[model samples]
Target: MTHASKTTTKLAEEYATPIFDHLTGHDDALYIPLLNHAQSQGDVSPVINLVRNEENFPYAIAHPLTGIICLLAVAESAYWVPIDRIAHSESCSSCAPIWRDLKNRVRTLKPGETFYAAATTHSPMGETRILIDAEDLEN
Candidate 1:
């Protein structure tokens, strides 16, 4: 496994909360669950009023090795799925709608799963999104 993966895994275990890929940006809706988990773990605050200003268990900004921003959301939260697009461009390339496929993909996500979608060398704006359980995604 890459050092970043190892670091993230270790951090996840230590924090006992899921760390999501941050490509979707900072949405309060997503932060709620994460804060709840931390609060449950004895964190003084339950709601994260300010992510950048956090004092305890600050959410990681990026994977240590991969340098990918980690979004982080609590498991089982009713969150909005990010819009999927082609690898390079921000536009969707599907002639036929793939809504069902995307929906199914999101539905299958569990607590320990890490959904990674980001740019790669081969494809600058990599379109392919990978959903691997925390156990399976380890480098």
Candidate 2:
């Protein structure tokens, strides 16, 4: 795990409080920010968002490469609320496909490359949470 401080300016631009970048499918523009945030901070735990409720339905993860794609079958502006790990464990089984695809992409990632996805009940939804290790990257 790693830790880093982020200024309000940076947060506003990336994690748009009232307006987010849009949690779309696995693309570069959507996921790159999450990866960049994690890489800059040296940890993936901080930038990841988890959604488990219907109120904050329709969430998308922004990618620096692919723009924005819907991850949870939600709209482009959906807001996702975070849930606990217990909920995540229980809901993850239903949400395995998303992570499986992300993992597959991770396997093909190169150095300085990044991926993003929405976290479900079981998986952490919202911004791109997974960051490939620098050493794992070929570049």
Candidate 3:
């Protein structure tokens, strides 16, 4: 490979290790489960989720009048399916109540909200996901 191309590849590899990719999942498991995983892993950086709707994670922007502006995106999907096996085997109907709760609670989450845990990964329905037994998590 050319020197420039090699450099670019190396940079990509270096950066890709930290990036987490998630799939179209039911409910906002990204915030609940993923967030919990990152926290357990001692990830100090904001959960950089790279799937559900592209967004910048904890990237700051400078402002002339103000000091600075920081933006964060919660990588949460808006879909929750029933647990009925007749349709989807990966149904989350058992967590229907939680989904309803999140439906209301998530709206109150601001982009600049402070948080302790956040995670992102490319796991399909069959793959294992980090889970926490906490009843509620508030930022």
Residue 106, model 2, lDDT: 59
Q: How displaced is residue 76 in candidate 3, in Å?
A: 13
RMSD of each: 15.1, 14.5, 17.9
TM-score, candidate number 3 = 0.21
Tell me the tens digit of each residue's lDDT in model 1 across 44-75: 21222222324533233333333443333222
Q: Find the candidate with the highest TM-score and give its number.
A: 2
Instruction: Give a tens-digit lDDT track for model 2, residues 94-133.
Output: 3344345435555687765664333323224434332223
Please identify model 2 stretches exceeding 4 Å from their true place.
1-91, 116-139
Better-scoring candidate (lDDT), 1 or 2: 2
Give the C-alpha miss distance for residue 107 in model 1, angstroms: 6.1
In candidate 1, position 92 carries an lDDT of 25
Candidate 3 lDDT by residue in tens digits, 1-139: 3222432445433422222221223223323322322233553222223222236233222211221221222333311111110011123454344334433443555654432222332233222222211221310
Clashing pairs in 3: 21-121, 34-119, 35-118
With candidate 3 superimposed using the best TM-score fit, by how many Å does residue 97's alpha carbon deviate from the native? Answer: 1.3
lDDT of predicted model 2? 0.31
Q: Highest lDDT: which candidate?
A: 2
